[model samples]
Target chain A: MHKVVTVDMEKDILAENRRLADENRALLEEHDIRAFDFLGAIGSGKTLIIEKLVDHLKSKGKESAAIAGDVSGDDDYQRLVAHGIPAANISTGKECHLDAHLVDHALEDLPLDKIDYLFIENVGNLVCPVDFPLGSHVRVVVISVTEGDDMVRKHPAIFAFSDVIVINKIDLAEAMQVDPRILERDARRINPGAKIVKMDARHGNGLDDLISALGL
Target chain B: MHEFSVMSQIIEGLLEESKKWSAVKVEEVFLDLGDFTMLGEEQLKFSYEILSKDTILQGSTLTINHVKGTIECDCGFKGEMSPSEDSPHRIVPILECPKCRGPARIISGRECTIKNLRLVVPDV
Candidate 1:
């Protein structure tokens, strides 16, 4: 006769990803690399901000590398490489977020020894990326004013968990009829301890403030 | 969607657990899905149906028990939150404290886990 058996697993669904993230953290620490995971929605200017950060770091004599995670194209990867930064392109075939496993693989392709800083541009999504931690020292969430002031209120979890919140594209705030102060208030409300920075990454506005907020 | 990816991981865990139990067939999987996770139940079921095909977990019953989202405020208030009407979707939780109206820390609703499983095995 066949009998029924009950197994008490009580396991987290994302446990594997969490384990790998810890391993990635250890690996990064071993290599003395300060990695930042940039998360945002599409058109939030994550790539441009990263490019600007890389340039600033380079000018300070600090070498930087990047891993661009996209669903298909390597456009962001190309942009970073064109700016004279080492970057790896990860095409997350049907996945919406970059998990720690993917970052581990991308780390294999980078020159970890030569890099002082690493920027991981997660798949351009605010919602999905919130659940997956990619083993970065700092998690930066970039939201543009063009997306509207409700961006933070609508996606509170990402803003709440992130270490730094970047309100990019402030140059068009008036043209878009969006106020950066409202975004800052919302972010502060969601995460009081998080450092909030407003900037126009394209025009290099507020870059120094962002740099200071990042403790770079 | 990420539901497919999450379901894939669940299926892998189920299969491994079944092997440990020496089960001839898997029967049911119970999950505690938290409201704060923002994972769709229908999407998760659909993903399970697709990913479990031909595996030991095929045709298994997937039961999801939704856990209510809760938060704790620095002002010493703790409770659940109702979705704001302004939210685009009902699943998006309001992270502010109802009492203090300040940013509250999520205390429980973010969990996505396999609580347990049932298997069929030969009586030995």
Candidate 2:
């Protein structure tokens, strides 16, 4: 005879990812590495901000490495390498976001003992990357003024969860008719505890503020 | 999209659970999906259908219980939030305290869990 049974699972779909993330966190802690996960849309200056941060950290006698995540291209990886930053390129194939598992694998490929700060540049998309945590010490979301002042409000989840929100490309805010203050206000409304830093990353503006905000 | 990846996880979990129970087939899946996840129901179903093909879960029914997004603020305000009108997709909701209009912590609507499963097993 066949019988139908109702099984009580109560299983979290992202439980595995969360567990892996915790493991990554533990690994980072064990190695005393400060890792930051960067999330942003394309053209949000995430790469530039990371590049600048790596440069600044290097000047302070701190060693830094990066894991550049993209869908296919290794352009960001090349940029980081061109700057002499040790970076691993992670191609997610068709995936839109970088998960903890991918970061775990990337961590193996890096020189953990030689690194003080590890920057993980996630795939360039705001919405999809919000839910996935990559075992970083802090989660930074970058948004450029060219994206508009309402970018934070439109993508509340990402802003709400981020520890630091970088408002990049402020130099063009006037030309774009977008006020950086408006972006800051929106970010504050969404996540009051998040450190909001406005920057012209291309011109090296707000680097100190960002560094202080990150406590690095 | 990521729904495909998520569905694969669900199927993997279901299969493991079925193996433990010695289930011959899966009949239905009950999921509690939170609004904050921003996962489309259609996309999830499509992913499920595609991923479950030729598996024990083939032809199984998928039921998604959408959990509304709610928040709790330090100001003692607690309730559901409305989607931001300014959102281009009209799906991303404002996550501030409705009363105090300050940043609030998400209490629900981010869940993506498989609460239960209907399986076919041999009579013991």
Candidate 3:
């Protein structure tokens, strides 16, 4: 005979993750460090924009550190290291997104006081990162022209949730046959007041505007 | 993609809960999934089936109840947004309030939880 049991979990599925994220936010607040989570698809130039931000911050004599999360590669971490600053990598073996627990562990060795800004580059995927918050003061989601115009519309959750939206690789819009305006309109519809930046990070275009928007 | 991890969490919870009654076999798992989370029910079930192998939960039936997305606006608008009619993806086509055209905050339909489980226990 089967004994049916009514297990009233009544628990939020993402509760643990959110609790860890809050802890990370508290730690960052203690050090007075501003953190941003860069989320985007794999080829959306997340690293390049970060490199530009690092360079811009360097010229201002501000120190910044990065935590790079990739599926199983040290490539992005090494690239940030090439900038000659403190950087670390969390290789999520099969996870599509980075959670607060991983970020909390990555923060154990960092010199938080010396860093002015902390950038957590989440594993490249638009969908899974929507619910995982890494305790960022600002959440920036990047979409490149190469990803096509429909990306923002198709993945509405990320665009709607991000604090800032970066449309990267604007220079390739013509070649990729993607109209940047379409993406901008879609983002606006999802989030009326979201700060949208059109960037060509390779040439450092629109970097200043982005910096001003972030107030960095 | 992260459904596997989520399914793993659900199974863990099931194991912990079943221990209280010393269940011998699991029969069915019922879930309440929200429409706003964009979680594919089929994918979640698939993940559950694959991860439950060799465990007590193996071969158990999975039942899901789709919860509708509800929202409230600062403008005093409160209602549920209908899931897209044509999109089999079940995405909420619009996120704004139809009454005021303002951004409506999602108030419900973001949970995925195990409502109950059917278990078989040995008669004393």
Per-residue accuracy of model 1 over B12-71 as CA lDDT, tens digit each? 888898998889888999999988785889999999999989888889999999998888
lDDT value, candidate 3, whole model: 0.85
Q: A1-216, model 3: which lDDT tens digit per residue? A: 555555556655776788899999999999989999999999899998888889889999999999999999899999998998899899999899999999999999788989989989999998898877889899999999999988887888888678799999999999999999999988876676579999998898988889988888
* Residue pairs with backbone atoms closer than 3 Å in model 1 (clashes): none
Q: What TM-score, over all chains together, does every model reach?
A: 0.91, 0.93, 0.92
Please report how far candidate 3 places residue A121 from its true position, in Å.
0.6
| Model 2 complex DockQ against the native | 0.66
Error of 1 at A184 (Å): 2.6
Per-residue alpha-carbon lDDT of candidate 1 for residues A126-186, written as tens digits (9 for 90 to 100): 7898778889999999999999988888788788678899999999999999988999987
Candidate 1 residues lying further than 4 Å off, grouped into runs, are B71-104
Per residue, candidate 2 scores C-alpha lDDT tens digits across A153-216 of: 7677798878899999899989999988988987887777788998889998898899999998
Better of 2 and 3 by lDDT: 2
Predicted complexes: DockQ each: 0.58, 0.66, 0.47
Interface RMSD of predicted model 3: 2.6
Model 2 regions more than 4 Å off: B82-93
Off by over 4 Å in 3: A1-3, B82-89, B122-124
lDDT of 2 at A23: 98
Docking level of model 2: medium
lDDT of 2 at A4: 97
